[model samples]
Target: MDVQPGPEREDSHVDSDVSASTPLRVALLGAGVVGGAVARHLTERADDMAARVGAPLALVGIAVRRPGRDRSDLGVDPSLVTTDAEQLVTRADLVVEVIGGIEPARSLILRAMEHGASVVTANKALLAEDGPRLYAAAAEHRVDLYYEAAVAGAIPLLRPLRESLAGDEVRKVLGIVNGTTNYVLDKMDTSGAGFEDAVEQAQALGYAEADPTADVEGFDAAAKAAILASLAFHTRVSGSDVHREGITDVTPADVAAAREMDCVVKLLSICERTDAGVSVRVHPAMIPRSHPLAGVRDAFNAVFVEADAAGQLMFYGRGAGGEPTASAVLGDLVAVARHRVGGGLGPGESSYADLPILPMGDAQTRYYVSLDVADRSGVLAKVAAAFAEHNVSIETVRQRMVPDERDGDRHDVGEATGNSNARANLVIVTHAAPDAALSATVESLRTLDVVRGVNSVMRVEGS
Candidate 1:
């Protein structure tokens, strides 16, 4: 709703009077929650959109598998609905794609571009996977491809990185981009609930889906991370390029451990321009409670961007749902339509930098490791030696007697710590190191005679 008209290309062949009178045809794919809202928006605000775009924007057709289903509630005529998406795309001057996924959506968009129609889509998964192909098609056909709704929904995130901050040098992008995971993690942090309980609460509140594998398992967030990384770093970052770790492994013990260190666990999508090239990852990491991202709770999304000129900028708002996501789709639709009437195209993919995506092994981040070790003199020395062997530096060490803690399940390992029969929970916080070396250090600790068990190991971030 706060979207401003982006600058059109300098070159224009169409006269202002001629372009203003020309009506642009719009075709929609998928009439789900987002699509239904988009239909209502176009029908209800036809006069407003036409005035904004300097030309009349007409809804020519709506593509749907089930045409008989009543869309009267959305003010869309039953006749506008058609099952043939291929035919619908070819006829329209502009295509607004809210239908998600890879197959039909991708094919239809390419077909639309081939027909010389500009496109606006909200499909992050498709963009992360085969964006370069789509970009190439749009460039070859000389049509615009705008996907402002792809990354952070209606938050106006991708546009700022791609356009607003185009002149600035972006160094890093850290975000809580997934609303479902954010709600689940926020519930766990505040209510002290286990991962399952928090996720159940999220589902009950309509924040998460019945099958939350995509959200909880971090696949959705990873896709968004790839898109963000590609835009911010000017690299061809795909979903496979990101190092993903789901929130499923995040336990109550890990949450409590974060409390002891004045931190909170959050599933963070991080992209950084490193000396090695670029690093992008999505994982549940511990951030200090005072951090800006830690305060983003419930089904709310926030992205913290760092640039050389801008310093640091934070964009916070709703990242999903029908209306919010539709607002973004509508924004792109308006921009592309204006471009059609005015002549010239919006910004295409900017991967000229073509930075290489660094592997997870080279990524550097702090670690919060909880180990069940013998509560004896030389135990710390042996553990310190293990870290030193891998060249990982230690920041802090906290030793907790199992008897002092309220949680009883932690000290179940008995008679394992030699003749002492006492196990101490050694919570070791490490300085930044390569992820591969940190994981190797944890593995080496497991083999140590002093350690009874490796309870948990989570990455620490945000200082």
Candidate 2:
């Protein structure tokens, strides 16, 4: 950082240049990929960023777990790197937190605001878990807390919902938010790979972590879902409030079944407003190919927002990566820095609506159920009765007969039970109903004597 003379030196006079363009000393937490990109931008594009922020931006320090580690290629002065994140947070006009998770990152950010410095963070877990605390700190301290990168990387999603669409009513927010699961599901859809093989491919390609539980199991997307729902609905929604289902249960049969119905399987983050209240959930769902979110293949992310005045809006782009996430961090840095220099705060948390998060069972949705049934008369009637037992109305039903091993030919499901020994694949699509009712229908089907097995059960969305 540029060594600015302290007022303790008792200078006779200061120039208007120094007064007008005071350097916004920035402390970066986490010298990982995202932090490295942020550092490079501050170093390589200092003049450009300063011009945009109406003040000079200076890196006070880069905090890391190991200051002695080889971050030589990260493009920052060695002297400016330190292990003391606590002290680093105290000594800057703005703090950029890329270190994810709760605990220390949360504590450090709270400390930064307490010390009277604004914060810009991409820590989604911390935000989704306890965002109200951070917002309260910023509001009480009169500081800015901007986190555009927390949701959709560089898509500029949160600002639009938080600012541009602030006047409008957001009815729903559906997205393919987790890149790792999206890549896995997309691979399964296109290459016909099984869930395990697709996940292996995603790990080899760096789309997933060594321990891919967070991404594949939907916890990562759930955190992002909570954040999106909170912003879109003007309510306080936390990670626990969001219903989470993983992609681990997705099978090759599920992928093929989706395609047979002109649909694709995606790990979707869905938030909606119902008559009861708002609902937030993340799960692997079957959506028609015509839907915009279905076309978002591979590791890309897209959020489809439906609002009263804005109608339907789709934000699409690279969802993850160091540089893309840092782009969002830098954007927030400039905005927060401008607020610091110009003497004002940007928007804080707005939970004025304070809508209660509805239970997952109450959310209205459709179901695509695949059943292995005995190839006998009255099988269809018995299955239909199972759905009716739970008040779930079936929209469509089709049967795929299993081929006889004796001859590579399909056996007719309508054939007499004495002549046919094959089981039939009975596919049923249900009309939109309460999720609990649809779930109960699946359970009831499992109990019927005509049903041999429940092959797959997936939610149908985007129609």
Candidate 3:
């Protein structure tokens, strides 16, 4: 397979060896797709890499869960493979960790820094959960720790935040970072495929995993949002800090309703700095079809950034997969290598701005609420009164009559009381309001006798 480098790869320059100096050796943790790709890239471009780094760069070791498995395709010698991940970190000048999760990846990264080795990783979950702690360790040891691949894969988001746009004050970062969920939602809209069928298609095409809860339920996007919020605001935000809602609740009716409003449904991870504090949320939302994010379809990603100086800027591309992810890893490796050879390091400790994370109830956004209500004389009036009670202004209201059953089953008032098919679908789009007010309005509507059921409630974005 051909190896493709990232945007920063062209700037890589290997240095000449000093009289007493040795080549910079790198150990890779995890032999998965990303790990293997990093190894392959390093070996394939060893000559160019050496020249770029101002010293020879060698792949010294690899750590894998199953050490006995054949990894010859990675282009690394079998002797370099090891099952003991902790031991591998000590022998190299730098460690690139792709193994995910919180336990060993965390421990190994800390240990590598303690041993005076620079570290690069693509583990978003680990970083999102405990970034401050890891950065503290790197600061204490004076070692470089970079994670550009954590958010939008192949998109140079992290470096842009840490370096390129450091002079500017970033106000908001709204991104579609999870490609699997995007793919599923796109299929649902374009092909009219249900959730299950779209997910199955994604799995078959390697766009989704067998256990896709992390993707579908917004866990993955939440993690990315936490990372983005931290970098953009120069604060510490964890996975627990983000309020996440998934795409599981989206239905065909919801899709059609969005289309009627000239909107498209997308899983959005939004991070913003407010007077109250930093707000982070991940949820399926409706974006106007004219918005740039609306054009992002299938398994692709895009991050829309709003800053003081730059105004609105967007970074778009493939966000996942081996080659795309590997491209990011290699880009970081080259930069880290150059910094090491020049005896210089990038930004040190993150000067946390001490921003508080606002609760989800305080988040402000518009909502699309679908209600099944009894088609009676005062049902709409009662519902409108309930919304007014909570101070929520309705932007648009769409009502569709439910068709009567073709069969000879009697449709009584009792049967139509709470049945969605027995009542008219009342779709209401609300103006931007406090989440608490929206919740109060929804609660009030649920208690009304004329309200049959709430089919769906989704946030509207890019309005």
Each model's lDDT comes to 0.87, 0.88, 0.85
lDDT of 3 by residue, 381-460 (tens): 89999999999999998876565444323343334343444556788999999888998899999999989798888899
Of models 2 and 3, which has the larger lDDT?
2
Over 149-199, each residue of candidate 1 has an lDDT whose tens digit, in order, gives 887878999999999999998999999999999988888878888889988
Give the Å shift of residue 44 in candidate 1.
0.8
TM-score of 3: 0.91
Instruction: By lDDT, rank the candidates, best first.
Output: 2, 1, 3
RMSD of 2: 3.1
Whole-structure CA lDDT of model 1: 0.87
Residue range 306-355, candidate 2, lDDT tens digits: 99998999999989999999999999999988776667778899999989
Q: Of models 1 and 3, which has the larger TM-score?
A: 1
Q: Tell me which of candidates 2 and 3 scores higher on TM-score.
A: 2
On lDDT, the leading prediction is 2
RMSD for each model, in Å, please? 4.9, 3.1, 5.4
